[model samples]
Structures are given as structure tokens and as C-alpha cells.
Target: MAAPSAARSLLLCVMVTAFLHHLQLQIPPVATAAAASPNKTDGRDDGRGKTFSLTLYQHETINKTAYMVVDGVTGAGVSQTTTPFGTIYVFRDDLTVSADRASRVAGVAEGSSITTSLDGLQSLSLAKITLHGHRGHRGSVSVLGGTYNTKPSDYPVVGGTGDFAYALGYVRSSPLDLRGRTVTYKMELHLYWPPYAHYAPVPHKPV
Candidate 1:
């Protein structure tokens, strides 16, 4: 009787050990680690990317930075009164760090605005903003959208080059001064780069 009981006990212990070994084989090390730390394997980690922002001032003056290249049927040059529909204006305005024109030049805002509305209060604008050593970044961002004369307007950043490669975001333009001959606009830019297009600083080539 004692021998039979010892044999049964040994058999039970062997069965339990085999069952645990089977479980160990079923769960992989990678899966176990992922389950232990939920944050690392979740979908939220994939969406992470880089972002950048900037604020610059654009000064527009008649026959200077702003000009009417294509005149509508109403007149030949920029209209002092209400601008006629179909009129087009081109600008290569200086972007400054501050509202003062004497401030450090950050870049240039080159684009065109076409009068879309009969009231001349709104226009379709397309612009390319080039940055020069502003915040240690050098690149150009392209923007296009409708610009309202009275209120602030938002333009989508469609593409970019150089340091701003694969950039995506928007620009908010607000008019600071419009009463005088020189109109000052405050441009607030919000830029983003995808995870794949990581921002790698370009090496300076000696001129």
C-alpha cells in the first residue's frame, strides 16, 4: 500500500510540472513584455511627431511691397477706392521679427492676392514664405486660402522645402495696421512634420 501511494504522488507532481511547461511555451516573450507595459505597444505611440511655430510681421505699402500687376476693367493700377472684381495684386513683402520696419529681417513673403468679391473685402491668396536663420531654421512654406480684409484669415500650409520638408500645418494672418499707407500684418504660423520626415539639420556648405 505504501509503494502504490508514493507512485501516485510522483505521477501527480510530474503532471503539474508538464502543465506549467506547456503554458510557458504558449506565451512568447515579446507578447508578455507588451502586455506588461501597455503604453509602449498602444496605437498612441505611432501618432507622435514633431511640431514648430513662428510669428512674423509683413509690411505692405502701395508701389512698394504690394502692387497690382493685373488691373481689372475698372482701372490700371491699385485702386484707391473699392477694388474691382478680377483684379490681381502681387507682393514681395519683407518679413520682420517685430512690427517696426527697422527690426531684423527674418524672411520674405512673396505671393499674390486676387480680388474675388465685388466689395473688395475678400481675396484668394497664395503665398510662399522663405525663412532666413529665423530660430535656427531655414526653409520655405507654401500657403493658400482665402484672405478676408476685415477679419483674421487662416491659410493651410500645403508644402515646404529645406528644413521644413514635409511640413504640414496652418497660418493665421491678422492685420495689425491698415489705416496708413503701410499696412502691417501679423502672421502666426503653426508647422508640423510627420514621423517619417524627421527634421535633420542640413550641413552648411562653404560658399
Candidate 2:
């Protein structure tokens, strides 16, 4: 009988110790995490009507003087000529376009959703995007083209014309109406060289 009583007491003590240990484990220990923040640009007024820029770096080995077009369909085709590196666009969150418009180039289509189309553009939302590439020769490479796939972040309450421009290319066109409604836009721009070439003339004797 005494032995049984002793075993019961020992078991009770063991259970109590385990319960206390569990309670200690429930408490979280102090932790320190060192992580970098994501890159971001200053959002304007109310996360709308803000202009931003993106830079791209490129390098390619081309033997001929051909133009590459960075295509933008609705938005301005920012990259005008073949540049090794430069600013691409000044995307405005207040800008947008209609649902249906004939594509500048065939085969290339716009993104269905506003968010998807603006994916690349939003990457520049934080700040200036720097594109990198190998340095070789001028006119050796060029930006070809791109298409806009998304709508702007915000639009005027009363439908009105919104104007924007591409920073890289001087191409400008506007009078776009964003009638108080949020709509997505797609930009498709292209790169190409002139068919003709110019050369210095040499004097020759006529016979």
C-alpha cells in the first residue's frame, strides 16, 4: 500500500513539471530580423495622378545599323531609338484608355486586366528603375516596342481629357477621355530603321 502511494505522488510531480515546461514554451522569445525594404516612389496626393519613370539597360551584338522599337500601343512608346540604357516612360496613374481599339501592330494583344497590363509600369512606382547592359557601340542596339496592358490607378470624377507623354521618345498624342470611369489601357510601340541610307557624294569627271 505504501509503495502504491509513493508511485502516485511521483507521477503527480512529473505531470506538474511537464505542465510548467509547456507554459514556458508558449512564451515567444525575442527576435531580430534585418531585411531591406522594397523600392518605391512617392505616391502623389492620394495614390493617384502621380508620374513615374523606369530605366532599362540593354546590350546586343548586331553587325548592322538597324532600329529596335520598344513598343507601346496606348501609352507613349517611351524608348524611341536603340539606346544602351535610358529612361523608358513617365507613367501616370491618372491616365487610361477605352476597352477596344485597333492594335497598332497585329498579333500583339493587350492584357485583359488593368493590373496585369501595368505590371511592368508599376515596377517603377517606387522610384527610377535602372536597366543594365554591356557597353559596346552606339546604334548597335535599339529598343523595339511594347504594349500597355493595364488601366491607370485613378481617373477624374467627371469624364475629361487626360494628357501624358513618354519621357524617352518624343512621340506625343493625347486628348484621351477618361470619363469618370476606371478603364485599362494597353500601349504597343515598335522599333524600326529607315529604309533609305545617306552617304557623302564624291566629285567625278563626266565623259
Candidate 3:
């Protein structure tokens, strides 16, 4: 009887050890949530008044070419020139990037606050440019549209209600003559979103 009892105890210990090993292997998948949730914005899971940060970038890549007349040219003849192209800036915002939607039914909308970073300019910079969201598509293009220019400063803040809605930034890339040289440039773009949505409770309540 004693021998049989000992054998049973050893069997139970082996089973428990196997179970512990399995649990150890399973830890990584669970820990992944703590690393970083994708598309999550700052101040998420917390109340309002939480300010986040983003990057406002602009770059110009030459694409295609067209000809135009250069000013102050001699003789009665036209001159052809290659067009230069580049984007001044671009903005992208995702409202409700991070929210405790699983806790409530009502959602929140993120809005944009016009921002600029001018001191970052060196010299001989172009005049500040502005954009109108409403004019683009009757306010359909972006939730809030306004002017922006070259500068190292905080970008605009964009948030809106509903589960999903995008107030996209405009893309401006057109050929322009700079001192007789044809050039193209695109507008800068930045995106901002806040977590303010909630999820409906399970077990629907009959109305």
C-alpha cells in the first residue's frame, strides 16, 4: 500500500511539472499586450487634458517634367525647362487611436488645432501657406482645415465623434516657377487622434 501511494504521488508531481512548463511557454503571447498596442495614442485609457506628440514631415522627390517659358529671356524665342517637384508637408491623424471602447457605448471625436514650427527655419524661407478643409470638399475632406507653414512646432490636433472618421490632410504637389526655374512642391501632412470611444455592454437590453 505504501509503495502504491508513493507511485501515485510521483505521477501527480510529473503532471504538475508538465503543466508548469506549458504555462511558461504560454507567457510570451500574454505579455505581448504590454509591449505596445498598435495605433494607440497618448492619454489613452485616461481622462482628457492629456497632450500627445507627433511628427510633421515634408519632402520633395522629383517626378516627371514639363516645360515653361523663363522670364527675362533674350531673343524672340521660347525656352524649355524641366519641372521640379517636392512636397512641402503632409499630416495624418487617427482619432480614437486608443480608447477604452470596451467599457462604454458612447464614442468621442477628435479635432485638430492649427499648429506651426517657424523658428526651425534657417533663412530665405517661403511665405507661410494655409489650407481650407471646407473648401476642399464642403468640409468633407477634413474635419478642421487651416493654414500651416515651415516651422518646428507641434502639429495640429484632429479628433471626431463616431467609431471612425478621417479629416485627412491635403496633398499639394504642383510645378511652380522659382526665379525662372520650374519647381514642384507638396504640402506637409500630420495626423492626430485621441482615444475617447467606448464599447456597448454585452447582453443587449431590450428596448
Give a tens-digit lDDT track for model 3, residues 123-160.
Answer: 11222222222112111112333322222222222432
Distance (Å) between predicted and true CA of 157, model 1? 0.6
Q: Please identify model 2 stretches exceeding 4 Å from their true place.
A: 30-207
lDDT of 1 by residue, 1-207 (tens): 999999999999999999999999988697544334221212222222455667899998888788888776542234443466778889999999999988999999999988888777778999999998787778899999988876788888888887877877678888888877888989987765554223323222212
In candidate 3, position 154 carries an lDDT of 22
Candidate 1 displacement at residue 143 in angstroms: 0.5
User: How many clashes does the backbone of model 2 have?
Assistant: 31
lDDT for model 2, please: 0.25
Q: Candidate 3 overall Cα lDDT vs. reference?
A: 0.28
TM-score of each: 0.68, 0.16, 0.27
For every candidate, C-alpha RMSD to the true structure in Å: 11.5, 23.1, 18.9
Candidate 2 lowest-lDDT run of ten: 191-200
Best by lDDT: 1
lDDT-better candidate, 1 vs 2: 1
Question: What overall lDDT goes with each candidate model?
Answer: 0.76, 0.25, 0.28
Clashes of each: 0, 31, 40
